[model samples]
Target chain A: MSENQSILVIGADPAGLQASKDIAEFGFRVVLVEKRDELGGAPIRWKYHTLAPDFVPTEKVLGPLIDFVKNNKLVIIYSSSIVDSYEQKDDYFKVRILNLKNKSVSYEKVSAIIIATGFEHFNASLDPRYGYGINPNVIGINELEIMLSNGKIVRHDGKIPKRIGFILCVGSRDKATNQWCCTVCCGISIKQAIEIKKILPDAQIYVIYMDIRTIGLWEKLYWKSMEEYHINYIRGRVGENTGQEKNYWLKEKIRLLEDLLKLCLI
Target chain B: MSENQSILVIGADPAGLQASKDIAEFGFRVVLVEKRDELGGAPIRWKYHTLAPDFVPTEKVLGPLIDFVKNNKLVIIYSSSIVDSYEQKDDYFKVRILNLKNKSVSYEKVSAIIIATGFEHFNASLDPRYGYGINPNVIGINELEIMLSNGKIVRHDGKIPKRIGFILCVGSRDKATNQWCCTVCCGISIKQAIEIKKILPDAQIYVIYMDIRTIGLWEKLYWKSMEEYHINYIRGRVGENTGQEKNYWLKEKIRLLEDLLKLCLI
Candidate 1:
């Protein structure tokens, strides 16, 4: 096919990859560009263990799509590349694609351009109250995903957490940080909770949240975590993760209650 | 345009309407079919007051789309109609359209067919434990949406309820009812909670759920309901809503606690 018949698809994410493939299948060349060195988007880059709602392995969902886009003869993938500039002509678009790796520039004309740049995960360290950067224990959900994928749920000290606590809406739904809610975090957190439960059955898990927003079919994750896994859901926002040795009294009271219950059972 | 060049779009909902409009814009005649008499789908049929997450008015979203599809000259609408039969030819499909209202039949041939038939709301009455059909006070989220749109949050006796309890996952995420989670309910319930709070400031709202799966940007609704409206979220499942007077002891205890708190404050 001629250059004018090519479709420029930015961001080699799942959407972009699928778009490129579909357009290519329709007897059109696709110029697929990605800022990252990789082809698959977040699921590949972040190494997502399992997707929420169904908890299907990330590889299982995105593997074939990525492979298809990568191997498609019609799809010209430009990894570590970005669209430097584009000029809309009468019929086609005059585009300048830049390679970030070796500082190379390629100019091409395409009939249409599809922008599929997926979202960037919110920086958890932005909110100091969560003690994300300060406290070693307070890692973001992204890091947790990696851990789950690695088959290890451990604290900064490399110790298995006995009582794990998930603080939801860390940077989301906060006027101070981001006014908008990071919708998937709730589901992701629940998914992680269930995973953690599966790994460490005896480990007590508590999800402190304003609301557990596992919307739609992802509601299964929330339900499963609650009913099957017995993960505790607390309705409240975290004021701050001081990481201080405070609330000893509450711990002591719980211990006493546990002791009393154990004696009664005996 | 010839009949073979036209495209058939099933269900004149938002998706179908949009699809029809787009196909028509591409210089192709679109035959839009709807089971209902109306052009707009669920939002119009259910008289939905406001959509969740953003809480945008239903009309504000679907009204224009419906009007556009209704006015589009290239689009032919068959309301109260069903595709009786369709035979796939070499390059086109011979379709028999039946209109329920007039018992009329129309024959058409289209090159492409777009099936955009949306989902049906789960029947809450199927689960007898919720007392949906038996109890007038126990209504589903659909009924709640209508009530919210009508600007009246009341029981059967037309009295404002002092204590409103929203039981989430009534027919959803239940092994006995539906094993699959009805994802939108969590967000919808939270939206309703906020709406009810706006109408009844003094009413104590409790959302009983296994998990409040208000996933994604809709997390804002959950946050808003909890932070602004102070809606109580109880983490548990309801076995049965017998509508019996067996909870008098708990009510008495709450009353006594309130009295004690009042005395302490005084």
Candidate 2:
């Protein structure tokens, strides 16, 4: 745990920043590298919906990530795409780091390496039926993240749509694409639903999904979104949205009530 | 919207708080009532994990809620429950209030009612095979919440059990029971799996779910939990939790993964 002992961390995201903080805290010299232009790679954030008065602001959940990097005395390289340049000495190896912005490269000898590169988002356009790239309404989770952060709600046509239909499992949990479930979707959807409902109280939200994968206490948030926000979740796959007529959108709007409340289905 | 008018809120949860704040801000007196002694009817916090380094501290999330109450002049009635509450009058409603601690009942007149009464937790003990009540290791979602917050990392026993299993659709999505997805179970389970993996690093966590219902960007959190947490999942139901193994207590513990990480059939 000496300053001379170097730690090279690839990828300057949450994992990389966290590693940098831990290493520096333990008296280790850490140098972080990112292929992206800036930090907070992939523009991904995980959240669950919460109800607030007057849609007032709550906590910035990622404050810790920012504080970690800011407090940690670690070298950070941005807009640099370090590539396969390594020098083999008698006992260890030296790595070559490249700076894409300046078109300059540098070599650094490190004792240890940490590869915290995160995963890529599953393309919703693969299904084609989901219409992620084709339809103005359909957007991936990352794009949705950006929109939610803007603090202003807008629809595909510039005017806010009265009804927004969110379809889950676009490219996830499909046997053809990937059998594994993307675990955070349930929370994210619930969080987004809460936000949408808060911003537009009267707007109708239809969530068509194969399943609602909310487990643990977080299950409470799912029901919170529905019971509080009045969101309607119907179990079904996305069957090619034809862009319905204005009158039909109002007429077809369904009231989802659990007969359990009445002890009978109407 | 006058100070003379008293608004009767059905429950003192998040939604009730918002309603009371809005109405009271408009120059109306608000009465917040809850059947429970404490606030936060359902404890589904966002962006929280026990062992996860990225978990945000409580000061950040709850700070706003605290600030709002201080700024707004409001009345909160604790240890009080509402009974026979409805719009009994044209301008004002006759509401019955009960003090559970003292077994005293009284009546109050109010202008409006907001039903923020959250849903009751699922009674998983009804099913004996699940060992909800019979087994020490087995517990419902609410109990798990307490254990998690109080640090039940390893399991019931001091030694970290090699395997951990989460059975989804416990009180929800069960046809014979509520017949509806409590809706948050799936994502909560995934987040729990990630959390469990974080605490036990090598502990085998399996989420046995019929389906994963993550809507939109919420699917992003689901994916993060699955891909990053290294938590394994099984697409099967636990008919029962009966077996005699290393210990009599651990025997009741559900066996989810044989070799967790590698995913061995045997």
Candidate 3:
């Protein structure tokens, strides 16, 4: 194939890998690039145990796609690489790809480019109110996923949490933090809640939220967490984490006092 | 260039239209088929006033897209058409296209086919507990969107709703109705609630839901509905809509009696 007929796909995430594979399957030469040394994106990098709604193993879903793209003859992958510069020409793109490891640069001419750089996990530490970095027990959903994936739902001190509370919209749905809702957090929390319940049935799990935004079929996780698992859903946002016995205190205007009182009593 | 190089795109919804446009832009001949006589899919067909989350006019988002696909020279549109039969050949598939309107059959060999038929609005009437069809006051979100878009937020009697209650997850996230959560309903309800509050500021809006699944950025709608619009959210699955005085009664397992009692008092 000619260099002008090649397609440059940036990022090695699930989306990028799938796009590259699909394009390569259409008999087009695909130049796939990943900034990191690894191919799989956030899911592989973050060590995501299972996906939301279904809780299917992350590898089970993304493994085959990643492997296919990595092994495909038509797909030429460059790890630790970044798109240094690009200019749109008459019918093709003049591109320069820089390899971070070897400090080498390669030039390529491609007809089209697909940028599929996925999102970054919201840094919970940015909003100090949650005490994510300060409090050892207070961990983000990403950390919790790793713990759950490893079959260890223990605190930093290696203690099983009897009363667990998931503070939703940590860095999301807040004018102070991020005005956008981290949509998957609700579903992830609920999925983790159900997983935790399966492991520790007697443990009480509560999800504190301004609104539970588990959109789409993932609503099953929300429903299952409530009905089957008996996980409690509180309709309020947590103001601050005082870290008193690793319990989250409510704001001034509490909506569900009964549940809060139950939490306090526990 | 050749007959086998042409791409067949089924459905003329936003996804299909966009797909056809993108493919045609890539210099591939695209056969765009729509079951309806007119293109532009559900949003246009349903007369959707505004989309959810942002509440942008449906036409504003889909208008340009439909127009581009229709006017594109590389795209050949077949309205009121269906793929009767398709057989995989050596390098392409021989597809028989049947036009329902003209009762004409056309054969084409296409290298690729994309099916982008969007979803159908859940028939709220399926679940009789909601009293959707029986009670004139009970209307689905689809109808509500059209009403809100028409700039009329009135009941069947053409009276402004003073105390409006949005029963969410009507045909979604229910064991009897649909096991999957109609993700958009929560955001749509919140959007409509805000729109209604804008028109009728004195109107009190309440969202009755098992779980508010407004995932991601749509969480803003949920927050705005509560904080700005003063729309109340009650946590519980509505058992039955007993349309007494055009009001809904709660189930035996009422979690928020305060809100329900407040409703009763109102």
Candidate 4:
């Protein structure tokens, strides 16, 4: 890692920020490329119950990274788009990026590429049973992020939902699909339940999770939410939707939880 | 709500802390009382996420409350234990409290008694799935709370566990028993995660929550934990324990989350 050598970071989420931090710490000229003007990315805006208090806004939590960028005079390309093109420049990998809004293309020399694009949600439209595309309010956790940022928790109908149900492992950890626990829904559900209670102390919240994956220091978070907050948790998987309401899904999908305790509770 | 009538408050938790400030502003004598030796109560032992950035401790967070206590000479009872209960001759609630280690009991009179003792945990033994009593290492969030106050993430084995599982909604939101969310878990969990992560960046963390409850302003903490520290949250419950590890479960109870993810990921 040479100070004169340039390093390219592909994504601009928490992972990318971390990578930039690691590389910049080694005295390398770094170029942080994000497709959005906002460097904070998903975690900054994505809606969910679980958030890290230390994970403040980009300008705040990412202060060290920003300072390193300023001190090193690193180039940041916001609103930049990248293509999977292989350019042979001195027998090295040369990636090309196009600025979508300006319609201008830029090229950069890279000594090493840190692929920290982070995870993505597979199409919810594919699973029509959830009524995602058919229902207005049937949105993923990411869509809820911006609204939550503004301290807004009400649905589009402007009604503070008395009963909120969450379906976890929606696209993750299913052998039929991309089998991986997005590893977040459980924590998000608890976080949301807590937040909802904060706003509407009387509201009822339900979390339907196949499993709650909270390990390490986070186990305490899971236990505290469950034992202290009083948010209900059912061990089960939600199935297809049945009906629709005023622009939103009137009926949530159904599925039988393998656990007898869950079935009896719900 | 009268200016001339001096108001009295008990328990310097959030409610008492808030009430003391509000009433004092109205030009009245506000006597805020705390049974504990400290002002912030359990929160002082518990690392909180919604604290000021100066790394302010729980006692310091009540700086305003403490100031009011000092300026107005608010009523404070340290090492005092509530003993005999009764009513006053003047119709106000009269109570007797014995100061521990001093071998003396004191009696006091008050116009009103605000039970701001906050909500205590239902206990770890209540949830057998967590292996609370069956296993010596499986402690509740409060146990970790004490250790965290000192700013270290140590395990029962005297070394950080490669993997620690967080089982959410243990006693509060059990679908079979209680359906109510305690409401503070998400924020507290986020705080613990960040603090633990800061101390042990090498540890693999997981938070298995039935749901996440960050509620309003605290949602920031939830997202920060998930996005920044790579704290993995799996939506699942604590399964049967049959392991014999002296730390996670026991010799015959259950094997805590596999101790590989944390090591392999980094």
Among the numbered candidates, top lDDT falls to 3
Q: Pick the candidate with the highest TM-score.
A: 3
lDDT of each: 0.73, 0.59, 0.76, 0.57
Candidate 2 chain B weakest ten by summed lDDT: B257-266
lDDT of 1: 0.73
| True-vs-predicted CA distance for residue A211, candidate 1, Å | 2.6
Better of 2 and 4 by TM-score: 2
- Per-residue alpha-carbon lDDT of candidate 3 for residues A75-174, written as tens digits (9 for 90 to 100): 9998899999999999889999999989999998898899999768777777777676777777766777778788877867777768788777666656
Q: Candidate 3, residues B39-60: lDDT per residue as tens digits?
A: 8887788888888778799999
Worst 10 residues of 3 chain B by lDDT: B257-266
lDDT of 1 by residue, B1-266 (tens): 34338999999887898898888877789999898988878768888888877889989988888888888888899999999999999888999999998999999989889999966677776776656677777776767787888888877877777777776776665577777765677777787788877888998877766766555577667777888999986666556555665221121132111100000000
Docking quality level of the chain pair in candidate 4:
incorrect
Candidate 1: what's its TM-score on chain B?
Answer: 0.84
Chain A structural similarity (TM-score) per candidate?
0.85, 0.73, 0.89, 0.74
Ranking by DockQ: 3, 1, 2, 4
For model 2, the stretches where C-alpha displacement exceeds 4 angstroms are A1-3, A44-72, A76-78, A85-93, A175-179, A215-217, A244-266, B1-266
What ranking of all candidate models by lDDT puts the best one first? 3, 1, 2, 4
How close is chain A of candidate 3 to the true chain A, as a TM-score? 0.89
Separate DockQ for every predicted complex: 0.33, 0.18, 0.51, 0.03
- Candidate 3 chain A worst ten-residue window by lDDT: A257-266
lDDT of 2 by residue, B176-258 (tens): 66645655556556655665566678776766666766554446567787778766655555666553342212233544432
Q: RMSD of candidate 4 to the true fold?
A: 18.7
Residue pairs clashing, model 1: A183-B216, A213-B214, A213-B215, A214-B213, A214-B215, A215-B215, A216-B183
How many residue pairs in model 1 have overlapping backbones?
7
Model 4, which residues run further than 4 Å from truth? A1-266, B31-33, B45-56, B74-112, B133-136, B175-179, B245-266
